[model samples]
Target chain A: MNDHDVIDNLAESDDCLFCSDHIEEAALGILEAEDQERFEHHLSGCSICRAELARLDTAVQLLPFAVNQIEPDAALKLRLHERFLQERDAEPTRIPSPRKSESRIRGRKAPSRPMWTFGSVFAGFCVALAVIGLWNLLPSNESSTSMSGRNFQVYAMQSSDDQSGGHIGADPDSKDGTMMAWNLDPSEKHEIWCVDHEDNRWKVDDLVVADSGSAMQTVTFPKEISTYKQIYVMRNDGTQELSVAPNQAINGDEPAPSESTPAGD
Target chain B: MQSLAEGHPEAMDLLYDRYHRPVFSFALRMMGDRDQAEELLQEVYLRAWRRASRFTDARGSLISWLLSITHNMAIDEIRKQQRRPQKQQAEDQTELMISLRADGISMDTHAILTERRELVRKAMDQLPQPQREVLELAYFNGLTQREISELLDTPLGTIKTRMRLALRKMQESVELQSLEAT
Candidate 1:
């Protein structure tokens, strides 16, 4: 059954053992083996009980939030980071693989294109198809681009909807960028697009709204910062931008020393 | 995580920046010792670095996964302490609370997220003390209902009832908040 249909059927009792007697215990995961097994069997078929169980699970999961947030010593963070870097660095030298050598050999021996001839037309067509396939494998939109390098820049896009906002960042050295939006319409599908001064729009990514109507997604863009004048998000109806930003304005602004940070997080 | 799994050391730093406070908070709350909490923090992230590939998105958010590790380690440390004499009491609770408020100066990117945190806090505060205590013991202490019943010297049924009532009240409060927000 569809989710709504199951939810509608929730009121109908399926003789749920957990709902009747063991809900709190099951949720706490403290039920004995037999009772826990029985509850799981009942839950698989009882949407009402399952829904209740999920709510209880949420309550348990949220328990940690009740604790006071504590900042660990800066030295602690530094020590852990340095140790991990050392460990990671050590991992590379221990194992040598043949894949790199194979790839390098193949790259050097790659065949060149043949002269144009009547019989060569089919081969040319095959080569064109292969190129298109490889191009498709490469990052077509900004969302899939790998982000790295030191020249990172961030831009905040304010949504016309006061509740919604977005941020985009680009690393010119890495040739890719990322965008994130929060406080969207949870039920609607949103699109991220980059617009040039000439009004040419390039679709960058698509976002699936979270249940809370807030979403953080990473996207990679191909073109350099100068190519796109603005980045914006939209619903399927194409009414207005959910959030938008000016590329040059953000790029020229000096990034904070910790701009490459989880500050927002 | 994909980057971490590919052995990129930089992802470890990013992951630490995202989760260290939450993990440390949880460990401190459960262990009640600053030194032990710091130890747990280092161990958990080190394990994460080695096992990044094992993390699957289907399980939950990265923060949740990190907190799970923190909780597990805290429980282990608590059990270890039970075997030996207790260490001297750590920092004062009042001092810790003040530090917690200060640490929260770093707000979420979304205003809605900030509101949600406040809503949860308010809802939790509204719960009766007995009910709140029982829930906390079961959650942070990782105690089963029976264990909590014995620890608190209360009947098992009473403990279960308190948890049920606490959860119901919190759910109602969150639902009301959602309705008003809409």
Candidate 2:
């Protein structure tokens, strides 16, 4: 067919200028502010335009079907599942500030320790109290806390700066754990993670560093701490191992026991 | 998807198995590279998993939303590289229809969707080449009508006409197929 005949065959009404102008962009969800506002405004009372948009939307959505189907690598699914697991388990805990009365009596002795608290639980409590006291000393309002339990073993986190340190604890019986880090690079977000014996990384949370860069933050995760061979801090993209527990690797090139191994192993 | 939002890993596995091939296929066509499509596929599901809680029925169906992610990611990569895809040779229409019809040989997940896909493919095949080209550019590449006009060197008015006509034809095809089924 000639170009003129083709044009004759295909020419359509531009009478609905808003529909003609905005439908494609709107369907793609890429309309600019003025155009987007104008399009929506026009749609409020125009059934024809709305109907046209719905038709265009269905066509766009169905475009995927035109491509010949191909399966993605199986490993990709595994990776995404692992990432999702980490995200699911690492629920960020927003630390609430202590009441004003507690702040006023920073100098006063901490209330008598609970009689039942002892050993690691007692030690964790004292550390928490000391951290709270230190937080009270800082000008910043945010602080972190932990759930008290004797099953929790606290690991002292060592960073380059002596003044900056934090504690991580996990219950061997339950896969639940808490991580608190201080003296991080305040300007950048620091992500906390735990590497299992198999070297699979689980992200704990992305902690936004306060202005002090040294501000302390805490996150809780539902993971058995013993499964993880070590804990560390890294940049948002997981670059740069900023700090670590055990202060060093257990030993170079030694294959650790698998995750399914017996507890004694 | 709701189960995924509730942090059930099995939901993710099932959802992945059902949709991964289609999602990967769409990405592969847009990206023109298997490796890149695979990477985009991984990113798409990861984003979906993280954002499942935000998905609601108001946004349309799950497949549409998933394809939208595929489109956006592919377009982003295209823009980053400042490269336009080389115009592709058209697929053999007979072969396409034959393969689509033959898709029913095995019992697969989302059987209803497979039938719908076959109908959409047939409708898409009926469009004139120019009309199909404009529609694909706008749909798969996330291009505005003006951008498509510039890309194809067609007059802006002609591009709009082709797009509108193409949608009308496809919509009619879908309606006709539904009627036939009934």
Candidate 1 chain B weakest ten by summed lDDT:
B83-92
How badly does each model clash, as a count of residue pairs?
4, 3
> Compared with the real two-chain complex, what DockQ does model 2 have?
0.23
lDDT of 1 by residue, B88-182 (tens): 23553454543322433344422332464677788899999999888777656656677778978999899878887887777777777768989
Q: What is candidate 2's lDDT per residue for B1-182, written digit by digit as tens?
A: 77875679998877776677678778877876667778888778866765575576686878778888778778777767767654432432122322322322234445655876898899999999999988888766656777888988989899878876787788778878879999
What local lDDT does model 1 show for residue A6? 40
Per-model TM-score versus the true fold: 0.50, 0.52
Q: In candidate 1, which residue ranges exceed 4 Å CA deviation? A: A1-50, A86-265, B50-60, B76-92, B95-116
lDDT of each: 0.59, 0.60
Q: Model 1, range A159-184, lDDT digits (tens) per residue?
A: 55344555555543233455545545
Report residue B117 deviation for candidate 2 (angstroms).
2.2
Name the regions of candidate 2 deviating beyond 4 angstroms. A1-16, A28-34, A37-48, A89-265, B57-59, B86-110
Q: How accurate is candidate 2 locally (lDDT)?
A: 0.60
